[model samples]
Target chain A: MGEFELIRNFFAAAPCAQGGEGVALGIGDDCALLAIPTGEQLAISTDTLVAGVHFADPCDPFLLGQRSLAVAVSDLAAMGATPIAFTLALTLPTVTTDWLQAYARGLSLMAQSCRVALVGGDTTRGPLSMTMTVFGRVPNGLALTRSGAQPGDLLCVGGELGNGAGALPLVLGERTAEPAIADPLLAHYWSPQPQLALGQALRGKATAALDISDGLLADCGHIALASKVAVQVECDRLPLSSALVAFLGKAGAQNAALSGGDDYVLAFTLPSVELPPLLAEGWPIHVVGRIVAGQGVTLLDSDGQDITPQTRGYQHFRESP
Target chain B: MGEFELIRNFFAAAPCAQGGEGVALGIGDDCALLAIPTGEQLAISTDTLVAGVHFADPCDPFLLGQRSLAVAVSDLAAMGATPIAFTLALTLPTVTTDWLQAYARGLSLMAQSCRVALVGGDTTRGPLSMTMTVFGRVPNGLALTRSGAQPGDLLCVGGELGNGAGALPLVLGERTAEPAIADPLLAHYWSPQPQLALGQALRGKATAALDISDGLLADCGHIALASKVAVQVECDRLPLSSALVAFLGKAGAQNAALSGGDDYVLAFTLPSVELPPLLAEGWPIHVVGRIVAGQGVTLLDSDGQDITPQTRGYQHFRESP
Candidate 1:
């Protein structure tokens, strides 16, 4: 067998590629088969990460394996879909057995944790990059979308935000700290857990929902435009993790929470009546702001003054105007 | 809006990104939603094309767009599934308006032709590469697989072959040919049609099926290994297009037909009873061999002697075994 064929076999033998509940056929086929039950809709999303662009060039492959899948699966979480399967299209500069083994192990562990099967994908030789496409099943007409928020909806988040962006300095070796603060931040960066359970719980409850990847303010802008309502963010209510606040000062952490991307925390709009039961059920629903009858996203200070910054979030490409 | 956001709008406004039959949600969302009919299984496949490895780096984005999607959708045809939707994860080093417009046009044209909707995708800054993940649906328990070919089945191809490999020399500008010969061959290489109709027609008739991406003989070996039967190809009966034959003489064309890796034609095994009706229906079914109680694939001469070549097909990453 050829080397790439061996690579295929390696992935096929991974624990995640083993048959799963909805997977009719896993790896080793032209196309993987998935059986979505009647009255359910399939949620699909694609994400691509490139070396030196999305992450450090010489970073750990195991961490990359986990982070890539997690980032893509987060979209399914935004849609409140139950995880089903994912396909990875990996492009590498060269073949290394150790790298492949470590990457597959990390992928398998994450897949097991998320209950997502590894379906079929292609491996090609090229500049280092990976594209992951995730699939999930959601009940028909019950999916939380970005265009459903009403004027009086309350804006909430699943958990603490900005840890991922705060870890960037440590990830790039530009800063160092005691392991206590650094470890948690690094873990959050390498493996931000997709809020799958919370998203599913918010089904038929959340008016508008999305995982915060392009920062809280910019993503709220997405919801505002799509739903045709204004999203008002109260800066004092932004959830800042203890680790993030310890690493970056209070003001820095707040700035990161507002504009630093890669949080992967679900920022959603919920009605006041739905919030009580969800909070009573021990879900980590943090109220950050509210939806109002306006056109765009507005950042308000404690005194109810507009204090929006110039840079909203990380924009990937600065093209010629 | 940022440049990448503008890029997103460019694709979102494309014709293929508009809603379709099975697409519950198209672009401009965290996840694209698809609604499969009751009693149907979703077939998913992913393919990646790197600029330098898979195609010329400075080649036309329009043709690259067409070829990338077609190559992925071919997997659905192999599984006898009706095309539904696809997502593209595109990574480019820089943003160019002309390139984006032409590429989107090509992608939309091909998507419309194949009746597949462009549901969603990601745009990132990196070296040029495109990963396409395609989705399709087939009746439960009726999708074609590579493990069901019986010993008595006849191996058949959907149409003519080898034009793709024959066009390679012309593609690289190493050789020139008459327009009549080169046009057909180049078109075959750039935009080979997925036999979706033929695949659905073979749903219950053909025992095993797959699109010929890795050459006929090598792909036949795949069927042999999966079905635990031997596939014998009669060299004299191999199908060849007139354009390919004119470009490369008989022996050269025959070799290309045996090991050309871009055919995208369906190779399947059918019982003798099923072939007559399919042929009478003018489905371009070309019988080239038969299955037997053996372990691997074998190429036969006109005198029925074994003549399998050493190199079965193109194997990416020729690492040490």
Candidate 2:
């Protein structure tokens, strides 16, 4: 099939466009028209993942598709934006019908899971990479932002941390584990769920919120800098998944939780008194630290002693280890 | 410098962001927030241009930057969408301050000219390529689409048609011309202005509209398929810029006007009754053809004899000439 037919047959017919809200017009148009509610503002996010850079070369097309959209959608969740639609800019060296089908299936699965409509996209021949831009809606004055954190607020995360980072060795084939341990970690790497509901719930309640893509420590530094306050993380309190601790012992697991990336979990701060209500509702909110009247992020031990590591989290353009 | 610093100093500080409108939040956020007027809908379009495929490798980064964004914004114009904001997903081979500076300068210039704000983007190291997703605003239900054309409508185009295609020889370094002739052709190749105003004016007036990127004949086929009407083009009526004619001569310029690509000129159809006001208002509406009750596009010679070309316009993945 021609490039146009490939996109039309696979992407346009993907589950994301079968039936979704806010997509006034989909593919085969000069532009996709989207309806935004009168008083609501549109939340937009973009992410690009390149082969052998973001994921392993020769990775599963389905998993790659799922991971690509999931990570991009994470930013929408970070802003308390309800999933509405997305556009895919896919560059491939060549078109393989088998690969396209599998990839579209994975993308369709995630788009269905997130309830995000695939409204528009462009496909071109190039090195394998996917750039997805997601759109969502948020009511005015209620949207969460990184600059709203306040002193005396409690720091929290949506769920376990470092699983994706912990899964790195297995992902690269440097190590292997039983399916029991591998499945969860692989899912973390390939299909980490974006905390959309938690972010929506925290809106107007949490002072600040963001999805953790670049390890907890580095991402916390972002909140700190933007909010103009210090975030003290109690290393002892980091929530590590049992699967992660089983694979990488206690200290290793803690290290992963402290510095691992691509968890796609919600991290935020709210008044101390505001935590109980969210907890009582059975939202997997883990209290990991607190916001303080200072700048930057500080790591503290169980005994309240500073135990910051020698290195921070991942930074792009740095030489790979 | 760190990756964040590179983006902050280069892209975020570009002139496009210095007091642009409709962007509630620009770069440096998990997602950019945008506000739309109560009765308007968001028009979204994405285009990805790859090195050595869409443009030449080792070309002027400044020109590439300007042309890349200008072409994508052309789709917004084709939809009659007003300038709003855009997100850029830029992939580079390595971090070079010189290239980044020039590229950003060109992008900023185009963004400023179009009055579009750079709301959000991501930067990463990879093969040199750019994927730009632009957002614009359109009054609800007033946007133009390719499916609205009807029989007996006059086919019109905005401005000259073949300058870019006529300039291809210079772009590939296969031919050279005097500066007086070459400069304008190169400008058409490197920085063709999107017909934004004409497109906006044609919103409700034109039955169907689109910007011509692929040659006129192929793109016209698209309108015929979508609108289910036959289009008859009068070869003698094709608009050719003076610079194009000077470079390629009469017959060659007409051929280029009929089948050359990358013009970014608006091609649309409207009922005979709707043409007067737009033409009377001094819009650069060049009537090139008329719609009939059939399928596909037909070319007629000056003597009114059928003279359709054997080949159509450019198609991605098709073998290069």
Candidate 3:
């Protein structure tokens, strides 16, 4: 088949939202057309995930597809915006019908779950890589940013941290899976639920927000730097899943919670007055620390001891020791 | 420095448009904020160019940078939309300051030319590839589509074709270039001029519009299929640069124009009315053919003899004969 036929078979058949306010034409064209609302603004973000670097080579194509789109949509969530449309640029070594079907199924499932429409993108022959660029719409000046955290604001995170990172050993076959531990971790890593609703609700309520992809400490450092404040995270207050705690003792789980990446949880800051209602929702937010009037990040234990190095997360381009 | 720092130093330093209608936040954050205009729509398109696959591995980094962005912007052109914002996902094998500088320079120059803001994207370590997703705004119902061409509409193309294809031999060291032919052909291939202005101007005027990326016959076939019509082109009327004609001979140039890719020229159809004064303004447009009530594409020679090839442009998975 020709390029157009391949695209029609693999992508054009995927599910998409029909006739939305901004989406004039969804797919099956040279470019996807969108109609933006008068008072709202559009947020755009792009990310690339390579097979060996981002996921295991032999991983399920369906999960890879879901995770790829999920990771990109997570950026929209971090911005406190709702996903409108996304374009996928997929480079594959070869075309396989079985692979394509599974991949499309996964991508379609997530796209439907997030209420996002698949727009226009390119397919090429190359090393296995997928790049997704997601677009979102937000009311002008209401989107959350990383630069609004102030001193004394509570540092909070949505959901448990490090489930994805903790599951890596099992995914890579380096460790055996305990049913309780392995299932949740694998689910978190493979199919992250982007906290779009929570983010949109926290739009005006939260001072600063970002998804934790590069581990809690490292990602918190991002917010601190952007907001020009120090963060004092309490080691004891970190949220650890019961399964994670059971899998790896409290200390090990705490280490993973601090340094593990791919959590896809929103780490945000809010004033004390705005914290109660959010905390009342019981949305798994842990008041791990407070924003401070300083320049860098510091981790404080229950006895007020500094435990920084032991909890620092992974850095890109740095060799893992 | 870390990967984030390297990206901030190189890619993020370029100036972006401060306050566009949809751009609530530009760069330097987890995700950008955009405000979609109430009555308008957003057009999205993405493309990825890999080293050795899309362009030569040792190609000039500056040109590669320009061509990558230009090719992506061409998608916006095809939709007859106004350029607004873009996100770039860059993967590189190593951190080379010189290479980064050159590439950034080219990207910045093109962004300035297109009046597009560099919003937000990710940078990672991997094989060299660049993916850009561009956003544009179009009026509610004025965006052009490939399905609008009618049977009696005239087919026209902007600028000369095949210079890029003709330059491939020289770029690959298969042919030695004389100074006269080398400069123009190299410029055509390296720094392609996206027909954004022409495309936007043709928004309501042209029945169907698309950029010729996969050569004339192949792209026209897209229009034909989308519009449910046949296309007939006069071979002698095909726009051919003097350099290409001299370098590759008339027949060879014709072959290249018909079958080669990477020509970011606009191919559109206009109703049989005043030619829209495109030529008087020094914008080169050659009227080559007309849409007909038939199934496929046909080409006519100077003597009115059928001369179109059975095959058209490159297919991604197909082997070259």
Candidate 4:
């Protein structure tokens, strides 16, 4: 079989959906097509993760596949869009059946969880890299934006942070992999759960919303600048997993929560009133601080003393190759 | 003020058609939204061009912009779909205002030409590379397929082939630029006129269709294998431009035409009742060969003797980095 036929056999398996506005056509074409509902708008985002840049070279292909799709789909969550379909661009040194199978397995698992269908993509011979372009649907003009936060809005996060970054050392073999530290960290890094339901629930309730791909402090700063408001993050109230606190001390865990990256949790601002039961249950919702009618972000200690951040999250420009 | 704002300003200035049939929302959001027509399916394709890989590092930013979009859009054309929107992932070493402006200009020009709007895409600080994911719409179950060609069909091409590959030496400065030879070749490379119109015109009429990005012989082989048929090309009937002939001798031009890449013209097979008016207006439609009930490609010389191709097009696995 030629390249095209081989691709069709392996990657062009038909997209599956159980009713509710699914993919109209998936794979085996120049582009996949979807049919969005009348009141919905398609949400789209693209992200590229290069081997040795985004993830370690020897990392499991399955984990890479899951993380790659999760990261792109997280953008949809930030926009309060419902996941629909995605396209993957994979550049590899060569076609290895074993590697492809493992990678496809991971990708299919996450896709099945989110009801996201693999639509189409290209495969080429190059340095290992994966670029996923994800598509979602949101009600017209209801999608959350970073500029929507008001001065009195409460700063909130949907889940624990820093576990992904705190677990990185173990994943890289720099630190010994203990079950207490490795399992959660590996889970956080390998298979991040995009908070699509939480985002959709926050459609009109949250004043501003964004995903914490970078550190909490840096991503919150995005809200501050975009909304032209001041943000006070109470460091003591920062959410941390029990595993994280035990592995890295309380202070170290706090540092990771504040400055670590790769936690695809929803960071949003809402009114101080009680949130919907749907959003408050199962998901960990922490009230870190509140927005003020000013600009820039400020961190506060339990005693109301100003605290300076020693490091910010990953900066594409400043990070060393 | 921040990365998000920077992206907003950079892309918002480009012209975009607002509130079309498929586009639910344009730019300035985490993801652009599209509402696919109810009965139609979407076609998608992605292509990546790296600096010093797809084009010269010092190549014109405008031409790079044009060619990058053109190459991706050509895939949609090959599928007999209508262009809708695209996302661009640009990784740059540094932000150069002049370079960005020129690149945006070229990108906007092509986007406008095809009426496809620029949607959401990511930007990163890394080696210069561009990945474009293009979207198009086609009627349900009506899109052309590479695997649809059958025996007894006529193999045809939309326009002149190999000018882009022939111009490579000049573009790399390995040879001096001569207008008689340089202009057409460069134009063909820089601003490829994707056969969208021709492709749309061939929807139900043609058996199989694809763009000639790799080269006539190589891409035709793709169709043959996909459709499980044999393809034969008439050497003397191959399309040639006067400029190509003037620059390179007959044999030299033939070799380039047969083996060169990056010519995003359409090659399709149709019944041989009446040819399209592409040739009468000098747009370069050549009936090079025919398909038979077998496998692989065969070439015939001027005297109808079987001729072997001296060169084959670029192969991703075989090319040296």
DockQ order, best first, reads 2, 1, 3, 4
Q: Chain B TM-score of all predictions, in order?
A: 0.98, 0.97, 0.95, 0.94
Candidate 1 lDDT by residue in tens digits, A196-251: 99999999999999999989999999999999999999999999988899989999
Error of 1 at B279 (Å): 0.7
TM-score of each: 0.98, 0.98, 0.97, 0.88
iRMS value of model 3?
A: 1.5
Which is better, 3 or 4, measured by lDDT?
A: 3
lDDT of 3 by residue, B1-321 (tens): 577888788877865434544576877777776655656677888888888788888888888878889999998988888888888888887778999889888988888888888887888877888889888888778888999898889999998989889999998888987899899999899889888888888878899989998889999998999899999988989989999999999999998898888889999999978375766667677899999998778989989899878886878767641
How many residue pairs clash in each candidate at the backbone level? 0, 0, 20, 8
**What fraction of the true interface contacts does model 1 reproduce?**
0.92
Write candidate 1's Cα lDDT for B196-308 as tens digits: 99999999999999999889999999899999999999999989988888889999999999997899999999999998899889899999999999889999999999999
| Regions more than 4 Å wrong, model 2 | none
User: Between which residue pairs do clashes occur in model 2?
Assistant: none
All candidates' lDDT scores?
Answer: 0.91, 0.90, 0.85, 0.80
- TM-score of chain A, every prediction, order shown: 0.98, 0.98, 0.96, 0.94
**CA shift of B269, model 4, Å:** 2.5
In terms of lDDT, model 3 sits at 0.85
At residue A254, give the lDDT of candidate 4. 90
After superposition, candidate 1 runs with Cα above 4 Å error = A1-4, A319-321, B1-4, B319-321
